[model samples]
Target chain A: MNQYTAQQWRRYTIRVGIYVALLLMTAIFLIPVYVVIVTAFKNPAEINLASTWQLPTELYWQSFSEVMAEFGPRFGNSVQLVIGATILSSIMGSMNGYVLSKWEIPGHKFLFPLMLFGMFIPYQAILIPLFEFMRDIDLYGGIPGLILIHVVYGLPITTLIFRNFYVDIPDEMLEAAAIDGAGFWKLYTDIVFPLSIPGFVVVIIWQFTQIWNEFLFAVTMTSNDAQPITVGLAQLAGGEAVKWNLPMAGAIVAALPPLIVYIVLGRYFIRGLLAGSIKG
Target chain B: MKNNRDRSIAFLMLLPSLILLGIFVYFFIGRAIQSSMTDWGENPAQPPLSETVEISYVGLDNYVRLMTSFTESSFRVSLVNTFFFTIFFVAGCIMVGLFLAILLDQRVAGEGIFRTIFLFPMALSFVVTGTIWRWMLQPRGGVNILPTLIGLDPIDFAWVNSQETWFQFLWQDVPRILTFVGIGILLIMAVRYALNQRWRSMGFVAAAAIVGLLVFMAGAWDYIWPALDVPAAEPTIAPKGFNVALLGVIIAAVWQMSGYTMAMFIAGIRGVAEELREAARVDGASELGVYRYIILPQLNPIILSAMIILGHISLKIFDLVFAMAGPDNAKTIVPGILVYTKGFRANAFASASAVAVIMLFFVAIIIIPYLWTQLRSDDD
Candidate 1:
């Protein structure tokens, strides 16, 4: 009975230790988020009066309202841009990946790595030429241009994700589908596309976060009217004297879509990460 | 005929990525290289469209100037900063990530909550991270003032603006020191491999050490010193050092990435059968020993993949640096910003392309091996 009590005590101590460590880590991780949250809810005057760590006396909607008034239309633009880019890129990547995995042409073995290496090309290296090229092509300063850029860049990782996913599916399934008189697009529409919801989730979430949060291409390619929320938020914060409350509100507003996606579909997001990194 | 039809279908399917990637990625890269060979944009006042503009070939002058000429010190400074940043940032991510993964792997309570909190940063933009960290690390603000609630004096840290440096040294010494560090690591790894009875792997490393020694003696690195264009402006030997101000940036990056590495590690750890660990424990191995000896060996591939990912991110780090320090801050300057500044602000297209090429080399060094291994592994 005494020995049993000692074992129970040890287990209790270990649990307590883990809780302490986890709580401390969680606090560290949450502090920036907390600061952003609290600052966003405070009015400008209250922001000046309170320490950054302190909660607002009362939740004020002024900053949020002001940010909405300024960037509301652009917020819509971000949504359209993200949704359009995500769907287009995910589908393109799915096709590329499916072919790369299941079907092979003469030069595919060479073409595969060439496509994948594009992921590692620093966008800055090609900035000048890309800008000139986009302007030349008449896609430089609009949502369509931004969408095109995202889809192109998003190809590498998305293709990689879907290719790795399809590689794991049993060949017997594809063989059975072929036996049923399915053609190329027919096979995809009936067998692969229907079963690709997981791939869609992974690629969509991946592209959503990437396209939504991307700054360089957005900043360089788009002008004031066409700017994404990232650039808009930076402009909001870049004034002579920064009004902490408003920009914080703008930051949260811009961040909300991805944050919501992550929280709701976090399991799929983690699976995407695992598939991308470990499988590579 | 059926095989040919299927092949045609596959080729047609690949044509979109092919056509697009060709134009944007490959064609543009070729354009950048070609433009880099000329002085098309060098005359900032005369736009390329201007009637009198003379865009002429400059041969390898831009590359030579950026490398050998010390008149443009910013390029060298950014290169050095990138080196230090990559080293520290990758190391920090791996260590913290592995620690968290191990801890969270203990079946802690509220695991889901902790995991979500940790991983959410990966989803946020560098713009947000930079904005928040800039505020938090300000001299009288968030992190520094946290102590005042406990009646302690507020810590005054000039986080993004400080000019202090550590381990200050001449740039000329870098190659020698790097060789030593390289050989040292290889020696340790060789010893480890030897102990594990991996004789062939140990022999390869031993050969590398000998080659490193021979290179060190040959003085080939002497030609690497940047040319002195002017005599009186700065230190004679071209000093290089780590800027303390980048701590905040590193902290923000690590915070964003540790969770990613943690997730990878946790997956790896989960793949290890529980019976293996329990058996180790039953054999009188301590928990630490189980982790160090049994678990880590199994997680090697995961660790390497994490490092490569982190390294790639580090090389292309621009948004965070720009948002945090702005483009003008010399201390936090890196090659990404250098490419932008040289191309746009200075209208030195050739110099920008050279920087881009160098950046590509860094990335290729990390990625080519990865692709090779992955493709080779698939064949088995």
Candidate 2:
């Protein structure tokens, strides 16, 4: 009885220790973020000499206005790009998934595998060729090009998701809808899309984050005219007179939009992550 | 009829994406391969403005150059670093992620806060995140501050790029007693596996223990010794040895990736059927046995799929390394970053494109089997 009691206490202590250690690591993860937040509010003079780990003598907001005047619309462009791509790609992906699940389309078996190969090629491989394609068509410098590449870039995962989820749904329900002679528009807008909102939300948030945070394609495809906030802000900081305060301010501004969207639609991000992770 | 319409609708919907796949994924991959063969690199300038720029069809010239060229120090390190970098990345992300996943999975207090905190790294762009992390990891920066406060000797980042790590990689690592013991166990287990026969349950357990030991040793040995010899440090910005900065850089990668891992695992856990738990209880199985047998079986598909995807993700990982090591030394990879440096920055766009093509091919060799299995398994 005494030995049993001892074992119980030991187990309790170990569990507590593990939890504390985890809490500590989690704190470590947040330190850099904390630094960004504190530094964003500090002055140029303050940030230059002040320890990144230390708080400034006073809360400074001078850089915020400077950042806003410089890159505010670019931030909006980024948002528009993310929302547009997420909606377009998820719509396309879900629709494809629904069709493949519901009907026996000719050549989908081959076409789908061919498309699956897209996920295999790294972003670097197609940079030049894609540039040539975009440049040839004159879509290389605008939001239209960014949207095209992003939608294309993200389609495989989104299609894979909608397909997997559609497979799990009963085919008889779709057949019943079809027996009523429902056309594609009615079926998609009413039946298929409504049923797939949870999945759609997940894909939307995930895609939004990707397009928002994307740097390379934004850097490559579009030069200055429609360069997403990622490339714009990064280049802004690349100047010789680059101050830590200004970039930290830009970074904080850049992070806030997605971070807000993330928090608002936060629940779906987890769901999307799981669905996206549909392996093992 | 509904199925017919749905099928057509699906076909139309999938069309744009199919075109994307054709142009971006499939066609680009083809171009990458073709570009590797063509003499795209700087050619001797000729009179009369040659229209073709002398696209010589040199089969395997790019590969040979990649293999034989010892001219660029960082280029060589990046190529060799590819496999080891991938191993460290996969190992780190999974280990750190699994630890957090388990921690967050517990019925502990403030779990949501912890989860959110851990996940915040995913929010920042690699450019900003990379630059910031670079500063933080600077041996002179205060990234080591928190550690210093704890009184457990803070790390000096200077030695991270120092020469001590370089010279050790080309030689065999000295074996310690623990490693020798591990070797003996492996020898015994290899003999056991070769002579597969009906053995006592204890023998099965013993063999399992040896296999586990081998895996553990694989990780330990990789960490304990440098993969390359550390040459003495030079005054220039050149990389010396398997720079210690690589490890610090990957630690940053781990921080960024672990949140996704945790989020994915949580989803997988949630998807596990509750009925299985009741069934296990009815079968009089212990809770541990229920988790081991039932929960794990269901998790197998999700885990395997995650591994394949994450494995490939780590293989192509560029942002984190770029963020941690800067573009020059710390994050060089064989295919991706090497191409970037050579092609665009170095003005040898031809060689860079060639490098890009080679990377695509290497990625294919890894991805083909994964695609085959996923499609086949789905078909089954």
Candidate 3:
């Protein structure tokens, strides 16, 4: 009884320690969010070096109103860009994955990695050529161009996610369809596409967050009329006089949809991450 | 005979992705290489060219200029900055990640809350994180004042603007550093040799060490001479220690990414069978011992994958740096920003491409072998 009590005491101590450490790390992680929230809620006059961490004594909506006025239209561009990129890439990826994993062809194994390597290539390495290519193709300076780039670049990871997902599917399933004389399109539409709803969710959420948050390509590829929210937010922050309240408000506004998705559909996002990039 | 039809169809299915990647990825890589080898936008003699700009063969001149020119100290500084950032950024992520993963593995209360809070930063764009962190790290703002509330002087560390460095050296001492690093690597190999008792490989390592030492002592080797007269001047900028400004950027990046690594690790730790831990405990292994020995060895693959992912991200870090410190902020320069500044801003296309290629090679060094093994293992 004495030994058991000591063990319980040790376990309790360890548990408390773990909770304390976790709470501390979580507080550290949430500092930026907390700062953004408080600053966003404060009046412009209240936002200064001295009161950066202070709570708002009174509510202020002017910052949000101003930020929304600047970012409202640009947010549409982000939505359209993400939606278009997500749908197109998810479909392309599903097909590519089906063929790569299920429909083995000559050199398919070799070809898969060659294509998969694109996911790991830094966008900086491809920026200039991609810009020039977009210009030559007459897709530059528009959301369409950004959409195409995101989809094309997005294929590798989406394809990887779906391929890994499909790899688990018993071969007998594909064989059964084949034996039934379902042609390629029929096989995919009938079986593969139907079963790929989970994969679509994962890929769509992944692409949505990535394309929405993407700043480099958006800044370089699109110009004044077509700038995404990320570029707009940066420009807002970069104005001659630093308007902390406005940018803080815009940062929260910009982060809202993805934040909501991360909170709501976080499981799928985590699933995609594990199945996609960091897989070894 | 019937298999040929399905095979062709499979090939057809792969055609779209193949063609797209081929054009955008492979074809553009070739284009970048070609551009790097040519003087496209550097000709001051020509009127500013437009879409159909003509490029002349420069024969490695751009690379030479970047490597040797004193006018481009910023580029060299960016390289050193990236090196230091990659080391600290990756180390911080791994350590913090492993720590969080272990804590979460204890099955503590509010696991979902902790996981959600830890991961939500990753959902925010780098721009957002940068904006927040930039404010927080301000001289009199967020983080600096926390100490004052606790009865301490506001720690007035010059975070992003500190010109001072820790381990100052000279650029000309690169070969010395390389030789020292090589010797250190050789010592590690020797220790491994002692443990594995592999005499033949140890003999080979010794021979290679001797050859390496001989080359190091030679100081200059002209195995393939260019026969050009040596320039009277060399790069004059003295090397400095890792920039302290990058500490801010590293902190933000680790904050955004350590959660990702933690998630990966938590998954890994959960996948580790409970029986293994119980068996180790029964054998008198302490909890720390169980994690240090039994669990960690099994988690090697997770650790490796996390390292590679974090390493590549650090090597190509641009968005956070650009958003936090503006483009010309020399204290936190990195290769990705250099590529942008050179190519887009300065119209130094050739040198920009060269830098891009160099960055690509660094990532390739980390990724290729791991990928080759993954693909090969899948084949079985």
Candidate 4:
């Protein structure tokens, strides 16, 4: 009886230990969020070295207004960019994935790997030529041009996720459809497309977050007028900033769209992330 | 005829993406390689951005200069920074991720809320992460002042702007250091092969290690790669290694990405059959033993996948450093920033492309093998 009681006590200790460690890690992870929130709410006068850990005396919401006023146009640009890029890439990826996984087009064995390789290369490797090519085609320095770049670069991962997603739909389902007089387009539109809502959700969220957060291309490819929120936030936060409250506010503003998507559709977002790396 | 027509339609549907990817990925890479071998900006007569610039080819000179020249020491420093950053960032993410996954696997309550808090950072932009961390890691303020709540003095470590370096080594001795590293890897491989009783593979690895050791001992690297020789214009030695300022950026990166690995590892852990674990437990294995021996072994592939993903991301890191340290901060400059500053700021197109190609080479070294194996395994 004493031995059993001792074992129970040991197990209880371990369980408590696990919770303590988890809570400590949780606190560590949330530190930046805490800092960002408190600092964003504080008046500029209250934001200093010594008082950083202290709560604000009262809520100061002026920084958000100022940041919103300055960042209004860039926020619109990011929305337009993400919407256009996400829709185009998701549809194209669905089509390409359906064709590659279902139809088995010739040279797909070669072509699939070739396309997948595009996603892994550093964009820096192709940035110079892309800039020149964009200029040559008269598409540089605008939201539309940025949209095209995102869509093209986005094809590899979007297609990869969708392809891996589609692989589980059972080839027999497509084969049965084909026997029932479903042509390529007919099969995709009637069967595959109807069943692809989950895939679409995953791809859209992933691409939306990626295109929205991207900075290097946005900074390089866009002119001042077409800058996204990320580049705008960088500019606002960059330099010897006299003010800290504004950038913190701007970061919260910029991070909201993707954060919302992730919170709402977190399961699918994780699916997209895992699909990009681990094979089905 | 219907089948053939359906095949044609399928091919046609994919044709547009194929063309776009061809131009955007393959053809542009070729163009970058071609431009890297040119004197577009190097020559005074051939300006980089001019519409009708006269271009002349200067094969590999830009690469040679980047590798050896004293004036281009920043490029070397950036490369070293990338090396150390990739190592720590990848290691930090994997360790933190495995820890979180192991904790969450314990059937804890409120797992969803804890997970959401841990992973919310992944949704935010690196620019946002960089901005927030910059404030949080302020020399006197955010994290430094936390200890004061417990009656301790405020910490004063310079987070983003530290100029201190660690593990410093001379640039001139890089070849020798690399050779020794290569031999070390080979020797380790030989030991593994020998343990498996694969004598042929062991012999090959052992021979390679011996050859590497001999080459290092004989000091023949300068002859093999003339770029290792010190240039005549600047005879002074330059030191390069890990910079202290990058720790803040690395910490921020790990914070944002560790959740990603956690998600991957959770999936991997759940995929491990409950019966296997139960059997191990029934055999009188402790919980730690089950994890150390049974579970961790099954997670090897997931760990590799995470490392590859994190490794490539670290190799091309730009925005976080750019936001935290600014582009002009020499202590935290990476090759990605160098490409931007050189091409966009200095109009040194050839040199920028050269640095970019080198970055591509490093990424390709890690990515190609992983992709090959992944695709090959999928074929089964």
Number of the top TM-score candidate: 4
Per residue, candidate 2 scores C-alpha lDDT tens digits across B28-84 of 767767766766655555211244566667786655555334444455556556656
Model 1 chain B, poorest ten-residue lDDT window? Answer: B230-239
Ranking of models by TM-score: 4, 3, 1, 2
Better of 1 and 4 by lDDT: 4
In order, what is each prediction's RMSD in angstroms?
2.6, 6.6, 2.3, 1.8
Question: What is the C-alpha DockQ of each candidate?
Answer: 0.64, 0.50, 0.68, 0.79
Clashing pairs in 4: none
Q: Which order, best to worst by lDDT?
A: 4, 3, 1, 2
lDDT, candidate 4, A1-280, per-residue tens = 9999999999999999999999999999988888889989999999887887778899999999999999999999999999999999999999999888888787999899899999999999999999999999999999999999999999999889888878889988888888988898888888899899999999999999999999999999999999999999999999885488999999999999999999999998888888888483
Global lDDT scores for all candidate models: 0.83, 0.68, 0.84, 0.91
DockQ of 3: 0.68
In candidate 4, residue A140 scores what lDDT?
A: 99
Question: DockQ-based ranking, best first?
Answer: 4, 3, 1, 2
How much is the TM-score of the A chain of model 4? 0.98
Badly placed stretches (over 4 Å) of model 4 are A278-280, B191-198, B217-220, B223-238
Model 3 docking tier (incorrect/acceptable/medium/high) = medium
lDDT at residue B80 of model 3 (Cα atoms)? 82
CAPRI category for model 1: medium
Error of 1 at A83 (Å): 1.8
